[model samples]
Target: MSPQARRDQLIALGLAMVGERPLEQVSIDAIAEEAGVSRALLFHYFDSKQDFHVAIARAQAEAMLECTAPEESLGDPLRILTASMSAFVDFVTDNRSAYMALIRGAASADPAMREVFDHTRSVMAGRVLDHAPALEIEPTPVVEMTVHGWIAFVEQTTISWLTDPLITRDELLAVISSALPALASAVGAVLPTAP
Candidate 1:
């Protein structure tokens, strides 16, 4: 295979492994073995294990963003927000270990890992900003701030919900889906009935 193909293959393998186990527990040796390449060959593409970790984290970040993109077909602002929020919850549910690993990096001392987490958060918040005008929500600094905080709130609530799952999935999703519009309302936007 070509170099780029080889790199993509390696990252794909890393993503698969991360879904099953935390990044720290995943070994470069095991990934090399899975790829049928020697450890040194793996290092040829990545400077170190940390570099490999960052690459896999970035790929997963991209996947999360892609999967959570609001459906343009929905058109209605509340519907779009509801669909995207459902996707976000489902994505995290589908990759619990991987999300935990990202959270670990987000809270760790390493700048690279935290960047990946923060970048994901920022992009997610930007998506809300993009859809704000449709809901008649003025995109002011206060609105932006609330949207960002809402993302963090959703993330934390999801994390906790996964651990205990005290409420039904529908109830949890209802609360999450309603959170942003309610927050925007506090910031002076009149949202239609939340989904």
Candidate 2:
């Protein structure tokens, strides 16, 4: 395989293994074996096991961002947001294991891992802010903070749903969708009113 392909293969294997279990429980040996490569080969692609885990974490974060990104073709902001929310629900439902591993596993605590998590949250918040004009709201600090909090709520709700799935996916999506207007209203309540 080409060098890039080889590297991608290792990362793919790592992600699969990590998805199966928590990062602390996943073995580097198993990852290498699954990739049909020697442990040394895996090490060659990544300086250390930590680097391998970090790479997988980064990939997972990027995948989540891609899944939630709004389509530019959608002219209506509400339609765009709805589409993004639907994509987010589908991605979490399909990648439950990987999503759990990334969000609640050891990666949650590692500085490198936290960097990716923080970046993803910031990106999501920025996307919401980008739609402020369409939402008829100013992108004030309160709105920004509300968006961040809403993202956290989404993450927790996803984790809970993945664990038990007590509600239907459509219901879960409705619950999430219903929160946007309330969050915007909450932000509005906090903003100073004109004299």
Candidate 3:
């Protein structure tokens, strides 16, 4: 495999393992083993475990952006918002383990990784506006914080749902959908007349 291919393989393997276990419990040797590469090669690719963690976080961010990128301008605000939520839930459900490990590790250990989390939050907020251009709200630090908080809340909720299989998808969607009004209100955006 080419160098880039090997790197991709390493990242893919890392994501797979995160689903299997928590990040703290995951080992470099194990990652190397799963990637079918030498520990030394893994080290060569990433200077340290921390560096590798950052790389994985970056890859995840890119993957998420690709997944949620609007194919066309979803002209309707509510439709766009609901579509985004659906995509988000699907992403979390499909990559539950990886998202858990990434969130846990980024929140605790990696500054760079945390930045990726922040960027994702901004994108989430931007998605809101993209779907509803007439929100009549100005971009401000407060808006950013609100968006960030909403993203974090959704992620945490999704994490809990992933851990507890009892939460049905519709139930999760209903709970999340019900909260959109509050989220929009907090961010100073106008909510639609009805659900």
The numbered model that scores best in TM-score is 1
RMSD of 1: 3.8
Provide the lowest-lDDT 10-residue window in model 1.
Answer: 186-195
C-alpha root-mean-square deviation, each candidate: 3.8, 2.2, 4.3
Q: Could you arrange the candidates by TM-score from highest to lowest?
A: 1, 2, 3
How would you encode candidate 2's per-residue C-alpha lDDT over 115-136 as one tens digit per residue?
Answer: 7677877898899889988878
Model 2 ranges off by over 4 Å: 105-107, 193-195
The models' CA-based lDDT, in order, is 0.89, 0.80, 0.72
What are the per-model numbers of colliding residue pairs? 0, 0, 0
Ranking by lDDT: 1, 2, 3
lDDT of 1 by residue, 1-195 (tens): 999999999999999999999889789999999999999999999999998998888898899899999898998988998899899899999988888888788887889989999999999999999999988877887888889899989999999999999998889899998998888887674434332
Candidate with top lDDT is 1
Candidate 1 has an lDDT of 0.89
Runs with alpha carbons beyond 4 Å of true place in candidate 3: 71-73, 136-141, 165-167, 186-195
Candidate 1: misplaced stretches above 4 Å? Answer: 189-195
Residue 161 in candidate 3 has what lDDT?
83
